[model samples]
Target: MIVHTAEVVRYVTAPAVTFEPLRDGASRGLLDHYLATLAVATGPVGLTRMIASTADMTARLLDFAPDALRRIGADAIIADSAEPSGPIIAQHLGVPYVISVTGLPLLEEENVPPPFVGWRYRSDRLGRFRNRGGYRVSHFLMRPIASTLHRRRLTWGIKDADQPLAYVAQCPRILDYDRQNLPPNFHYGSPWRNSPAPLLDPPNGDKPLIFCSLGSLQGARKKLFAIMAKACAEIGARAVIGHGGGLTPEEEASLPGNPLVRAFWPQETLLRLCSAAVLHGGFNTVLDALAAKVPIVAVPIAFEQPGTAARLAHFRVARVISPQRLSVATLVKALEEVVHDPTYRDMASRLSVAMEAGGGASGAAVIVDAALSKLP
Candidate 1:
């Protein structure tokens, strides 16, 4: 419930901006540039932009605190894990806060491998050494964001308390909202539950149902979705595509029809009917596919997607095809392999069981109760 209450855009903003569109109104090559280097290459421009964005959003959120308190009168704050805003705002308002993470538990433990580094979880000395230094260096690069948050706090006349890590580490409760075919042992967090999706009647019988979408921001990639539509058509599967991006008449017209393309679709409800999915590997989409026992053809574009794609492939429930290498032929081939192979489905089902056992929403309630009881 600790969500950004931005009207209309609440569903879009989170841990970070999706590589869906350009920030400066420059559209054509923004995604291309991001996919080329933003995956692993963090540079001055990227870091500066990241810091500026987070700082600006945090201030905006803080601006709303007074109104939010008057309207909701909530006792505590539940913050998204992407930015330090939650903790900062909670501290400013004198309330206890718990973070709800939707991605891998990278910062939860020192031995847990960093996601951006693209390392597998290994307990060996070499792995631990790498993880330790890797986390430190990663956080070092994040110093600018931290500095910005501090400066904003001072501007608001609040005393600084070195609250970033203290806020994260001292969070008596952390809720990981997803399980994406990973080892159950590494799955930390109080589980949040999902309702069983209402199944849809497939338009075509016996054809593999492939649900395709790039999610919130990237859904605007008309070209990529068009390619996916063609691939699905080539393979003769009934594809239902959700265009999360608000494509106008002209842009939507170019999308292929063999795959049903719509401005939007109820993704959770739709996944119930899918045999396989072609996705940009967003966190929610991955978890939904795992829950539905659907194998994935992961085409990671940016953010934590590449890391998620690596893990999914390592788990054998997915085949990774980087956007740079994405072609109709390659996309069709990967989907073919995943659809025909029983192994991916079996593994995906196993993950689904683990995910349910982890106690989705109910587990989160228990943690929140404990956190509250600990207070005074």
Candidate 2:
């Protein structure tokens, strides 16, 4: 497994798995700054800043990954969709590669809005025009990474070919907006997990339990946690917060409602016990929540979060409150509505069933095997 030095500590690899750390890359500080920038940025400007922040990291991956992968004699590559360099490196190395959509799939379709924006899915001519315009803007913003890839491809004497052997997303088709232009090789898969997570005992008390998580990347927002806690408290719900090591002990203690705030927890286990979830629209957590048949209240902060939240709303499984507009009262209203309404729970349950039918990691593996089988 190849990953950044900072992320190496997060994984618990099996005996057969070896982690190859990419060193001297983006520092923790730079990554934090990038996340911070995205917290306040929105629209096309936010997208531009996001691409600009990752320019150096993209260059480093292009410089290091091809040689490292070649040395390892890797026969096939499974590249994260978020990392564009992966497909390029595989092309340069002449290896078959599969693109894994860990977050929202970045595939461009005229009827689908770009993943960064919260625009609703539209199939009309005007909507298609708008969607195309969004892609053009995204393509323009991506020139920095594109330039790096072009230079590397030239140096390696490889022609431009970014298409993957297969594409699998960590989302079920029902959770996403309808897409008419997906590649034939594209497959909708389930969230990757080793096994079915065992359900945990619900927290003691009759107060409706609500799981609140901002995921690892955006968990550091103390104010957001505080707002969620306050809203849950007002709604007479117990807020179980997993901030992913983002909060200091003092900060955690300072949150309202004396909410059960931990740096980490068995999220799937907690979701099973919760009546509703308050999320930052992180895809993995959203999947976990839906899998538990729990309704949601989404506060989208950055990246493809808004788009994810929009889908949740489109399906009537969640209520979205943009971070810029989020507050204790707004969250309280969303939380109460989701918890008390049977429709939200019903929709979530339906999606959960659909998600299971699509199959999880095992289904994704089958697609990968088939793709590789087609390779020479």
Candidate 3:
């Protein structure tokens, strides 16, 4: 039987890991949930970067003891296939590794340019231009640093791990990026299709409905939650929100007593029902919105998020707002434009058709099967 396993390899510490840090029980719980899914399909194995225990020890062992990987009996190692920790371990195990690009591919060497540069590169012409230059420089310097950290903590030796054979991106083919340069084996795995059914029935109201979310990871911040709340208030449209990682209990409790606000609306359901959305421009949210044919207003926070927001603006599928300038007025204006303007909705709907045509579960399954084929 072919054994399949996932390891965490990228952004396990600085950003992705920090949100819930698998080291902390919160992140670990999420990891466990996904691992359980994989376990049902393939079998479970430990995913590290859990709470950021000095991965140094784990790396050293994998670098030296190829047998450790063998002991796991995994035929293929999928990195970020579950989380971002697998590819590093797979690299040292001298086994085949597949990098999973669940979010917009942000790493340059990986050829996955940050999603939505069309917007990010233009937000503030001068400031963004300078920031882009700095980001490039920073990325150059940090590649090795990131690589070193991966080597030291995930493998027996940094020098021993081989770069992965392919990556499975979560984006749909409609949002096909220009930067992913890996082998043809690199694949895109869409989670929207993989997700459960829409959380609620499409809104039946005649007035335009607006849905708001910050994706799942960054939904915990009170300030951002407040911004979303205020935006919904100003729009005066029917609204649904999935707090994701953005709201506090108190904040949720305090939501204005308007039918417009909800703490946990199924995003896909709401997107399908809403006339427009105001979101953080996360890859998942953007793709899901596009698939649902809903126009968007993106307020990006960090990393590839800004780029993703920028792309929606460039495509005219959504309005892109800088986090610094995302005032209630701007949101109200953008919301009105998307809701009232036929052009925006038309563009979004056409893109939604394209996104729908781009296969989802089948694509991921194809990749998974191919990875298995390479195994002994």
Candidate 4:
């Protein structure tokens, strides 16, 4: 059974999956504000606001989720990394839970920067110092969430050690920086997605195809989509844009290259035919593009996107551009490099092989089952 927000019901199409929506009045509005904050957040200030909003949402969840889960009689909980209330609620219900990191994992190491930063992995003394500083800032921003969790734990008589039974991330270990301190229960799993159905009629065009997406949250940035469309046109490629229902009909009609614009699409199907991709550096999209052996031009906007883009650059599979510096000219240059160079595609192919070996959702399910088996 899935305990989610009411808005999530539309996406829950699996026949066997049952869901219960948290009856919190403030959850939707708070979540909207959080996403809005992430769309334009640049540094510490924006991150603080995001954390504050999350704390507010967590409080709401704490007020209602325990009762909801009790009513449903959930034996075990699988929680998204973004939801901090999950572990606390699981403890309140005395149920084993798993942490599902659908995006970049937030684990901190001295040699690796926090997930919010775009800094590359560095192991040298100065690099470690920089990473430590970044983590300090991250901790500072997360204080609100920490305080909320602490208060709730105290109220519910839960321990400070709110550890999950298993911590599974969709990020392939090969794509992440070396980590010597991962928890024993942590597993690097592949992207969680169903097999793609064959496209009834694949796109037919002489021009090299480029897939562009900003993901669901930031897909409403019409100006950014315009730049992507213009850049693709300048490079003599066809751009297929998926805005995730974030665009209006009139706005979609104005994009350059006479691009095909849609609210959603079969991403994997289209990506298999593309030479390169333009993205907001969302982890899932990056994984999908790599799985399809497509190189990327990443314009990271907020959240863990910059960190994901940094990893892509580290692997030489993508060119990372800051959203602040994004423009038709800059995007065109990045696209040209990724499209014309074979090295990017080659590296992506290598990672694709590694991801296949990492065992996708099935591998994660194995870890989860093992964890739950040990529970009393």
Which number leads on TM-score?
4
* lDDT score for residue 284 of model 2: 92
Cα lDDT, all candidates: 0.66, 0.84, 0.59, 0.86
For model 3, how does the per-residue alpha-carbon lDDT over 1-376 read when each residue is reduced to its tens digit?
Answer: 2222123333233331221112211332443454333222211112122212223323333343344446556566656532334665665455677676777664543233334243333334564455566557545533533564564554355554456766667765556545435456666555535454655446565655677786565566556556666666666665566775355566776765143444566666667767788887777778778878888888876546666776677667888877688777777788888878888889888877766655575776576677768767
Two-way lDDT contest, 2 vs 3, winner: 2
Report the backbone clash tally of model 1.
5
lDDT of 2: 0.84
- Output candidate 3 Cα RMSD: 8.8
The CA-based lDDT of model 1 is what? 0.66
Evaluated at residue 225, the lDDT of candidate 3 is 57
Model 2, 1-376: lDDT tens digits are 6544355544646665676655555566655676666555556787677677677677877877666676667899999988778887888777889999988878888888999778887789998999899999878878988888788888888876868889998888888788888888889877887665564554788888899999887778899999999999998988999998889999999999969888988888788889999998999999999999999998887878889998999999999998889998899888889988899999999999998888788889899999899876
Residues forming the 10-long window of minimal summed lDDT in candidate 3: 16-25
Clashes of each: 5, 0, 31, 0
TM-score of each: 0.75, 0.92, 0.70, 0.94
Give the C-alpha miss distance for residue 91 in model 1, angstroms: 2.5
- 2 versus 3: better TM-score goes to: 2
- In model 2, what are the clashing residue pairs, if there are any? none
Q: Which candidate is the best by lDDT?
A: 4
